[model samples]
Target: MTKLYTICFLLLIMAFGFLTDAAASESSFVDEIKNTNERFDTRAVPLARQVTEESVLAMEEYQGGSFRVLARKKSIERYRCSRCHTGKPVTAAQGLELTHGNIALAHGTEGPGLTCIDCHHAQERDYLEDKKGRKIDFDHSYQLCGQCHFRQKRDWLGGAHGKRVSNWAGERVVYNCTSCHNPHSPRFAKRFPATYSVPLD
Candidate 1:
């Protein structure tokens, strides 16, 4: 009985030895595959580097020439960032302190409520109209303002708010109302001058 038990233990040891040899053989095979892959990559390294260099050069050329010109055209407009909003004056009124452009009045830290994108949506065009013939034309300045300022428009229509200078007999093209009153800094009575005097100056 003891001899049979010893034979069974020897058979188990032989099975473990075979399993160990199989695992070592798999590990060696994987190492050889990795080494071959590394050698192939080394051979191709110069070609890969040349491709990368050409791509970078092409990118730089495109950015320097066409991209820069397009950026300048888009950015340097009549009313770049500060037209309706009053942080900076528009180009036409650059040096002037109190521009006809929208700025604040009657309070601390006030100006035009219009945002950059508010007027310049839909492919940076200020005006766009749909199929319904309900037109949106910002270049016709008063209409651009009239769209959002319904309350003011109502008053203008009812003859209560806006200043009516001369009753025209012809096609009544009124003044650019935004010229007199800043939509961002609306006033109740005509208290200050048309141009504001900076408090420090």
Candidate 2:
């Protein structure tokens, strides 16, 4: 009977000790909650302000000084277009398809349909020519696009349209228009909404 009492008493003491420790922990946690204003200052947190080298491709100056843009000519498959172009006119014979037969020209609107030679330089296959016959580098193709899309160009220059590849607090690396939109089509394809609606019975 004494052994049973001793075991029961020890168990009760242990339970009380555990409860006390738990209560003390809760009390400390509550005290911590009460002292919330004395916590570490958010302003002291370090921020990533510098843009990494990989984040930039090429930098150009606009009205707001220098900004970065993704390189266009670097991304092209057959970049230095002079390889097979040969600067000769492509006159197709009966049943003879041109080399770039895959490129379906869907760029312009109502008119006598725009041919490849209209935008591309006839004599210089490596360059795109403006309406004034000035040579435009593939990297600066935005100049050609801006000839018609002046409004969007204006917005792009003003940082209203287009996107910046850099984060909130780094070098301003703006994306070229061709980054998001296809130069040939430019129209964004219709995509399904992210949130699926509940099925109505």
Candidate 3:
């Protein structure tokens, strides 16, 4: 009986030792995997270069140049307004009631008293007419707008009004008044402000 008990105790001790060894081997394997993953992550990440003011200035100097404003007439997809109105004459008394019903001439301080022929050339139909009846190309529509709103034109030329193309430091290619303001209804409609993601409080 004593010998049997001693054998059982020895067997229990051996089982415990095997379990501990297995546990130790598993721990080492996990640590090795973790180290390999860390090494791979470090190798995969790219190093970012430091951006300096001098580098930015140098880049600006390289790309900087004078650029002319893009012509609006060339940009217009549907420029066939004159195609239909070539033979037909727009009377100042009748106004644009039949065809131009979609157009809401709510622009300018003059109100509804203003007519289509006031700005548009009645004779040419293709080109815009200034207050002096001079034919102004659609590309140079700014000249026609400047005839009445000289102050706005001056501000637009000085870079106060309208959006600029590309960067502000580079070429000064600006959009015409017609780009932002609609020729028919220049007044912008009122709307609710956009919702913020971050809490104000």
Each model's TM-score? 0.30, 0.64, 0.55
Q: In candidate 1, how many Å is residue 47 off?
A: 86
Say which candidate scores most in TM-score.
2
How many collisions per candidate? Answer: 1, 0, 0
Off by over 4 Å in 3: 1-67, 74-78, 88-99, 109-112, 195-201
lDDT: which candidate is best? 2
Estimate candidate 2's alpha-carbon lDDT, on a 0 to 1 scale: 0.74
- Sorting all predicted structures by lDDT, with the top scorer first, yields 2, 3, 1
Whole-structure CA lDDT of model 1 = 0.45
Q: How does candidate 3 fare on TM-score? A: 0.55
Candidate 1 — worst ten consecutive residues by lDDT sum? 50-59
Residue-level lDDT of model 3, residues 63-128, one tens digit each, is: 234334546665555575776676756666655566666677776757556678888888777788
Q: Candidate 2, 17: how far from true, in Å?
A: 18
Prediction 3 global C-alpha lDDT? 0.67
RMSD of 1: 25.5
